[model samples]
Target: MAGIYLRGKTWWGRVQKDGQDLRQSLETRSESVARGRLKVWLDELEALAWGGKPRLTVNAAMDEFQKEHGPTLRPSTVRRYGVSIDHLDAFLGDKLLLTVRSSDLKDFETARRTAGASAPTVRRDLACLSTVFGFAIEKEWADINPVIPFLRQRAKRGLRESPPRTRYLTRAEEARLIESALPYVADAILFAIYTGLRQEEQFSLTWEQVDLARKHVTISAETAKGKRERTVILLAPALAVLKRIPRHLKSPFVFHHGAATTTRGARRALPSASTKKDNDGERFNHLDRGLRNAAKRAKVPLLRWHDLRRTHGCRLLQEEKWTLEMVRDQLGHRSVVQTERSYAFLEVEDRRMAAHGPGTNPGTAAAQEIDNATGEPIAAQKPAQGRRTDLEKLKKSTA
Candidate 1:
């Protein structure tokens, strides 16, 4: 049994279960409200006794989740989770896990948006919060995941999403950009174009992973984006880039760089340098700045490093006429559907070219016919051979 009594200024709740006395402040002076609060508290306690969800705060649940799962995650992922958790705690730290309704989540989303967070950033925060709630449900600290339905509703409305990028570099554009780029950047560009490796994968690659004899580099599961080991074939260009890249004795990175300033006016060394580096070595981490300067010099605007990788996939799909599954495996995509979705427009274009006979249109020859006397282009004549045969057959059948 549970009941409430009036103290001097507030109402206090008392409950007895399993020969133990439990008391708590209902934190209200109104009798009816205090009675309701006490009833809810007792219900929670009874539920807990029957192996139901226990009352937990958002902060507590997040802490437990981090403690339990943080060690298994990558450092970068752990850092990202920490950032999301910090944002989440600022809004919903004091709220009980079970009391976090969809409306409250909407409010959080609104707050993040109002604070100038982009749609993707806010979605990531909510996703992290939702993961915490899922952990709470698994632990029986929460009964329902409110964020799941809220996300579904947001998805149905299709709010605040940017257009997908489909930019790929042409051969001339690649050549001009490489000609204007620094030596190290040029190497990276070639490797990226040839191997289609992600920026992280390429930058993090070490000499140990490369097998010169086999002409392949193994991306360990820990280093891979999909958390699965993959092998990237080294084409002639990629292998040539590797052969030209000088090995650094102290550095383990395949694409290592020297210190920024050997002196005030002197530029960074090319190929490799003997400047001191940390345990991981002074690797080429910031590529965008160099790439931007090179693109500007090359008179190419809006160029990105990812465009190199995109060029690889597009060339393989469009020029080589590789199947979708082949491109998917080459690009390290877990599903062929992803490869098809990205390059499906190329396939449509290919079919159109095939139907039109390469560069010629359906009736280009007739359209190009010029009158000898007037020297003027004539109207294209429609093909009537099949139509005349069909009409003759119809007339014969009628007769």
Candidate 2:
């Protein structure tokens, strides 16, 4: 038999079974409602003690899921997951794990959208929740993964078109950017352009990575974006930049700016630091600001810092005439598809040129007829006569 006591408006039960006393709270403001709820709760507890289902809270399940699978992810990936979970915890705190419905997820999606998160960003957060719940279902922590089905259907319908991707720096813009950057930053920019090294890779580059005699740079797995080791063949321009670097046998960094040493607590600090002028660590920001100012001064289009990398890829595609595979290897891309996706514009321009053929204009049919009658390519004819004049002068000078 069970004894029930009324505490305020709620009822609590105390039952003695097998020499053990068990307590259960019936959460209700009405004594009659609490009494009815307590009877059902006791039955459920008895069934659970004899191999029935046990309910879990959202917080407990998430904690369990994280403990089991969190270590497999990379540090950066783990940080991103933590951020997403924080948002979910804020919304669904105190809810039972199995009680969360698809409608709750939809409401959360709406709230996040109203708060100005992009669709892609929201999708990624939802993906984290979906994965967590999926794992919970696998572990028998929850009967169904509410986030999974919602994510699949919602993701397709809610997909937003991403921002336009930008690539490449125009010649004049490149020149102005180089001229404006501080000496060390200019060197770093040139290194990035020539080597196609990512910003983090450039920052963490060591003297060991460079082979001056071989004219190559070996990027380690830890520094590379793809998590794979690769080597970049350094051209003469890239080599020249490397040669100009003031090497210290003791210092490991390739570009150890004075600003970095002073502010970042490098062993050898810079002397006579200025409050107005940036130190070595802050020099990158100054260089970025300088580029913006230079773009304004030159009346050029706005360019991002990453435009240098795009310029490198575009130069390889256009000037060097490197194959897509070659560009992929040089840029350390994980897949050729990534390279093509990023630089397919170059291929489009090439195809357009090929379709029209060189020196032919659709708007100038008469000019094309004149060129056809001349029996010469329009661009080659002028250069040929100029070369003839130079050849005659050269023969006269030799005689």
Candidate 3:
């Protein structure tokens, strides 16, 4: 049996079940509404006691989930999930799992946003909370999942999402950045720009993964963020960077000492300075700061290692020789949409170039005569047959 009570202006229901108490807000002011909710809650509690499905405290489900799950995920990922769990536990307190409502989740979002949390950050926490709820459902500790419904109905994607970055380096900016950086840092920037490898892939790069003869570098599943193995085809510039990297006796890492600061003469005397690395992922993890410092010196805009990866993706996708499918695979993205979101900076660049470009529109030349500035009849300009042949030859050579 259940009892209904008027709490302030709202209704709440409480029932005794399996020697424990279940309580939740009915969220109504009317007496009839309170009694109706009490009846339904009593029915549910009776079913639960009769072995319909057990329930859990939010804390209990999270504990069991962390203990039971083992997917060989990255250490950073484990830490991130732990952080999300900590936030959820703090917010939930001793709340029961099944009583979580979509409204409660919406309240949490409003509170977090008020406290300066971005939508993406709140979304991540919700996703982790949903995972915990899913685990509870899997163990039959809860009959319903609350988070998924909330995410779908309450916070559809793009609520307060920060804009995706479109800042990729131009060739001249890249050259200036490279020249401004230290030797090892410069090599890393060049390699990342050419290979489209993420920062972790770059940090975890080892001699074992590189095959000079095969012209490829294999990123193992453990080292890659997507937990999938991928092979990056090495171009001539990448190969040149590889050949020039000085290997040392202390480490087998491909890129070491990104923060290495030594005069050329001193570096020559102590070749181990270049290889004086932990040879682990922990070392040089903060290489972005080094790049920023070099950017300050070079007078280029502050650039991240990821921007180089984007630059590579944009360049490859813009090239006439490479197919979009090929670029998507090379970027190691799960979908073309992911590739476009990150590297589609080129879309705007190309459009701007074409609109104000030096030449007449090739497609429009033979189709019809139209004014460039206004929609009016004008003399049609025809490109010569030889000029078209020259364009074909250039495309063939580039391809």
| Highest lDDT model number | 1
Evaluated against the true structure, the overall lDDT of model 2 is 0.67
Candidate 3 collision pairs: none
The prediction achieving the highest TM-score against the true structure is: 1
Would you estimate the TM-scores of all the predictions?
Answer: 0.70, 0.62, 0.69
Better of 1 and 2 by lDDT: 1
The sequence of per-residue lDDT tens digits that candidate 2 reaches over residues 9-59 is 677877777788988776667777867766776776786788654566666
Clash pairs (backbone) in predicted model 2: 259-279, 259-280, 259-281, 260-280, 260-281
lDDT of 3 by residue, 212-302 (tens): 9998899988888887898998877788999977765556677765324333322323232243333322245547865885676655565
As a TM-score, model 2 comes out at: 0.62
Q: Point out where model 1 deviates above 4 Å.
A: 1-49, 74-76, 259-280, 348-399
Candidate 3 lands at a TM-score of: 0.69
- Measured by TM-score, how close is model 1 to the native structure? 0.70
For model 1, name the residue pairs that clash.
none
lDDT of every model, 2 decimals: 0.75, 0.67, 0.71
**Predicted candidate 3: what Cα RMSD to the true structure?**
15.7
- Give residue 85's lDDT in candidate 1 (0 to 100): 97
